[model samples]
Target: MITKTFKSESTIQTLQLVQQELGADAIVVSMREVPAGPIWNPWKKSAVEVVAVSPNDEPQVRKPQPPMQMPPSLEVAEEIPEIEWDIPAKKKTAKLPPPIKLNLNPLSGQPAPVTETVRMTEPTAPSNDRYSPPALKKIQQQLTQQGVESSLIERLMELSAETLSPSTLADVEASKRSIVQLMGAELRVQKGAGAFVSNNVVAVVGASGSGKTSVIAKLALFFRQGLHKSVTWVCADTVRTGAIAEAKAYTSALGLDLKLVYTPQDLKEVFNGEQANDLFLVDTPGYNPCNEKQMIELGALISEMPSRCTYLVAPATTKEADLHQLSASLGVFNIDGLIITKLDETYTFGGIYNFARKSNTPLAYFTSGRETSRNLETADPMRLVSALFGKEWNK
Candidate 1:
């Protein structure tokens, strides 16, 4: 029997080649898959290597050779005693396995061809979404666990996948970079952190426990100490207990004044009495944002102070659906932008990013912890993107 090795781009091609080389009597003994070229070209893939042998024209006779017989006398075997046969004295030899084969080509570090049961596909260009970068699966799982909505997650994946060039898909790192850049570019970022400062009064409102009060303190103290501006704290949160004392303590500790107001007219008078350049950081008591009456009431109270900018304070760990509702409900208040809180508490900030993108509201400020006035800072797209990904990402 004569044996030959054949290689082609696909299973059908390999079989055709076998038929061409050894004619109709050719029998495939082995087959395997290998990479197309150096660097694993995704455009060209799934080459098959087949080992085939030719069938004999006729069966050949196998004559059994008689076993060697030793002479009866010991003296006759003295000359042959020098030879050693230390192998097990079995009557028959065990069939030897195929010789060790190793293919060490630089492009493909694989073992030599051998028999295989699996079929190989033809050479085909990278198709379908399966060949997407490794980062796609990683980001999908990360966002899914972070409580991002399935629709938003799917949209993000689809958008990023569309941006992936053939070259970008080949390198996962590049794919990750491209996606981050694309998201950041499409994002709505407002650089005017000081825009609200320019106005006389800044009214902060949000759901109860949304960190509205803490953000108020941070903004008031940050402006007073950092920018050396005169800031007055106002408490419109008459409902929640200790809410008055919380605003008073923060203001008094910094030698600033705090005002308490119950009605919209009361807040209107306080702003009316304040100096022209004084920064008024008004903190509103948090309430269930889903309550239409509560939101309308809050909006009316904020509408009292003229030249005021309203901000919807929210936490980063909030659910995506809630974030959307928060954006929509706060729209009644004529919200100028958003202030994201609790950065250090959770790793995910994608909900906020998506919220800002969907709401078309700029992220004015964000904080890491409840530091009196220290942890707060202006928003940066790169930093926010990095926080969302839970890793370093290029903008």
Candidate 2:
């Protein structure tokens, strides 16, 4: 059996070469598109990579042969020697030596069996009496006393014996801790009431249904009331229904200025004429990742903004594949940080971990409940780690 991979822009050329080399017995295993050189030339667009397996060696065939007839011998067989035979070897009953006992004192110079070394190195099997649920519960209680959460302990206990073997349990815990370390912390509300006012210019961008509008409203209240910053809400979200009106209504109730911009030029004009004292918060349209036109349009608008883009993510409703796809599509825009919303709805923190890991984006804020701006917090790794393992923490 032979396997080979070939790359060629022309399918005919690749197939001809493969057939010539493998004697037409080659089977194509797979084909994949790969980037080639400059795109200015149509010939350099891409290449097809073909993987093939060939079996050219033939099995050896043997020639059939005729059997021969045997000649007869007429000699009488000679009597075989009568070997000495003792029934049951005369039933030997030799006296066995008495068992030797070793001295218990350490001073006794006696060598131990090599099996002792193996026993010391190899893992010992658990005794039948040691496989008690109560014993496991006691161990769980001890781990809880040492600050491990009871829920995690119980989950570990519920795992099958093979899954939760002593060695495997240690490995699982170590992996969990490593994941927590990488994810860092849970998002916490920004400290210092005046900090929100210092950086009043904000931009929110993310996939559809990620709660950007709700987050923008919460921030509006936070800055207008909590930080006492003059707020001007700008809407660049022309694609979604009720997006501009929703933002306008929310900001209007707080006596904040709301400007609706249809294009990047409109945005520049509005920002240029805006009051210096007012903090401008731009709301972008929620984009479907699959819509390349929308993404390109939104990217252009975001690029025009003076402030960096803060991507909003809804962890509770986001599936792993969707999150990854969303991240890839949004990568066109320079995503500065992330804001995770709808944390109150989901218990699994794996999505959060996976998102942060895949995107390499730092968590900026997290919204646990549908509270006003005060409920949003800066991300804290410890809180997230505790929450992921179902550990109770001081709220």
Instruction: Report the alpha-carbon TM-score of model 1 versus the true structure.
Output: 0.61
Q: What tens digits encode model 1's per-residue C-alpha lDDT throughout 151-247?
A: 8677767877786676766675676676567566655655568544647688888888888888888888788767777888888998898888787
Question: lDDT tens string, model 2, 1-395?
Answer: 77777776655445444554553445665545667788686776666666666665641222222222234765534232122323466685543222212111111233211110111246798775535344455545544544443454555556433344465344645444543453354233334323543344688877888888788877777666766668788888877888867776787666777888898899888767556667788888888889979878887887777564455565545876788888787776666667778877766655665566556776666676665545676666566655656663225
* Residue 251, model 1: Cα distance from true site in angstroms: 1.1
Summed backbone clashes in each candidate are 0, 14
User: Candidate 2: lDDT over CA atoms?
Assistant: 0.61
CA deviation > 4 Å runs, candidate 1? 1-130, 147-171, 392-395
Candidate 2 lands at a TM-score of: 0.52
Write down the lDDT that model 1 would get.
Answer: 0.69
lDDT of candidates 1 onward, in order: 0.69, 0.61
For all predictions, the C-alpha RMSD in Å is: 21.4, 26.6
User: For this target, which candidate reaches the highest TM-score against the unseen true structure?
Assistant: 1
